[model samples]
Target: MTPEALSGETLRLADAVAADLEGVERLGVAYSGGVDSATLLALAVRALGPERVVALLGVSPSLAARERTIAHRVADLIGAEVVEIRTHEGEREEYRRNDVDRCFYCKDELFTRIDDEVARELGLDAVAYGENADDAQRPDRPGAEAATQHRVLRPLARIGMVKPQVRDVARVLSLPVADKPAAPCLASRIPHGQEVTPEKLAQIEQLEAALIDAGFSDCRVRHHGDIARLELPADELPRAVAPGIREQLQRAGKDAGFRHVALDLGGMQSGAFTLQILNARGSL
Candidate 1:
């Protein structure tokens, strides 16, 4: 669609989200600084005013510093009260187990904390998140299950908004993250079954930041034992393999403590390792 047409659709979606929030006396957003959550926060602020809308960011070892900064900036732009809650997902054995449902335990800890501290203490009417219609159809998002268990509201999903719709609305609202790439938790880089550690998370974050500094967006530095498997977009493979770029990346990985560095020709994908596991189990 043309930019203008997309903008129009996005405005409509934003209006719908705002309408839903209008009746809420006080609403807390599960803000992640992602385009989806940022867009929803913008709408909530517009609907309930800044005083009634609270943007809650769950801080954990898995959270990237950049992500937290962006989320705070977005909340500032909307004049919303941003609450940074330090979460101990790593402390939870179930979460640190790194199973397929690891996200479930992480989010469960998050929402429960929000419910106890933010909602009850602050007297918020509801705690909402940015899950959209597209995510509703995705089977592997265990976090969504936790959100449901905690009775967290999903305004975008409730309004029938999908990924494209959220992006469109974000553009209409002029959110800085309107076109930002998805950046899941740092622990996501570790293959399932590997215990998530603070040091490992820090290493992944630094390596990914270096990759971005090297001009590779939408990438992942997947942790595999002593090896770092870089996943660049398929279209960027040629650039990534240019004369000295591979060596540079290898050095960066080695500095991060990887003994060997390899590029995955299959390229960047969300939950690539999880998909591999699911496929191996004939679940996909």
Candidate 2:
């Protein structure tokens, strides 16, 4: 859509977000440095001044150092001050188990810490997270449950905004991460039922960073103990499997401690594994 058409169609969304923040002197935004949260941060700052907005990023083994660095840059671009707080989600046995409900425990801990500590110390009136309408269609998202339990605001979902609209709004606001690909937690690289450990998370991060350094921007390196399953866009899979490039791919995976490197020719898909589990359980 053209910028004008995009704005006209989504103007009500912005209005609803502003209305949601009404009566709140200050807002603490749960930021992950992704496009969704970055757009929310920009909107919060636009409706309220930079001084009224605080970007709260919960950091730990799950969050990548690259993402944290980019988050700081995005916050600076938005002129919103960011606070990086170390979260102990890894210490939670439920999270360490890496079950289907892993996200619930992880987010529960982060939101609990922010609500009990960050909000109290910062004198924030309300806490909000970036959950768009597209995310609402997914039954596997456990983070939303934590948000509901904490009574956190989901203005984007409330306003019926989806991923595309959020990106458009970010572009209109001149945010740097308008079109950035989704980057979920590093722990997500581990399949369900696998124990989540700092070492596994670090290996995943290292492998993903190596892939990006080698020119695969949007990809996922799923960890399966000694096996590394690489997921890239369908158009980019050839580059990973091509004659000489395949060797480089193996080196990258091996350097990250993977005994075998395999390619998922079906390509990179978000929530692919989660969808399978949800479908089998008749939950989706």
Candidate 3:
């Protein structure tokens, strides 16, 4: 919807986010070019001005190349300066273990880097990430704990803006990624308890890029040892299994080093394997 089409409630929520950043001299946003973060960045730029806001992107193998490119494009669209930081989450053994809290270690590394380097050099008074209200209440988001520990502000969650509200604000701001699907780190493709390695992440990225090339943009290639468990949205499942498309997907999986390719009938799910592990361990 256009900016003029935004409802009063949505506009009020957007104003609340800007109001939350009132006293900060300079702000650093943990941006990933997704709808939530993009909306936050756009609003922050509007409130604090583009010169006062910096988009900090943590570059690592976990981040897909395509995603990184999109992130830069989005930041440029918002007229905010982009800073790329190297995160060593992979060097942390706890992160490499790939537990349910893997995101915690990754986020911890990113925030730590920002605190040690970016904050001081860039004169940033505060940091924020795009955690919406829905994510604030979710059990799957251990990364929120890291954000809390780092004293990073969550304007969207603080303003009680959920995913739909965030998307609405994004559309109102004319952000390019307003309707983009959520794309988690490549490491999430591995089942919980499986060790996260650069190889696995690269393989998952390769197959996913191939899937996008084959016309399935929103999909997941869960790395299950020798098998690549494909997860596509329900509506795309039929197309995936079609004769020509099925063979294309199979070849893509094999080219990515999978011995067998399997399509999950349950469809694409966010944090699917992690939730299953959490359930089995009675942590849910």
lDDT of 1: 0.85
Worst 10 residues of 3 by lDDT: 1-10
lDDT of 3 by residue, 248-269 (tens): 9889899999999999999989
> Which structure among the candidates has the greatest lDDT?
3
Which runs in model 3 stand beyond 4 Å of their true positions? Answer: 1-7
Instruction: Evaluate all candidate structures by whole-model CA lDDT and list the values in order.
Output: 0.85, 0.88, 0.92
What lDDT would candidate 3 get against the real structure?
0.92
lDDT of 1 at 176: 83
**Pairwise lDDT winner, candidates 2 and 3:** 3
Candidate 3 to native Cα RMSD, angstroms: 1.8
**Against the hidden reference, what TM-scores do the models get?**
0.93, 0.95, 0.96
lDDT of 3 at 102: 98
Instruction: Arrange candidates, best lDDT first.
Output: 3, 2, 1
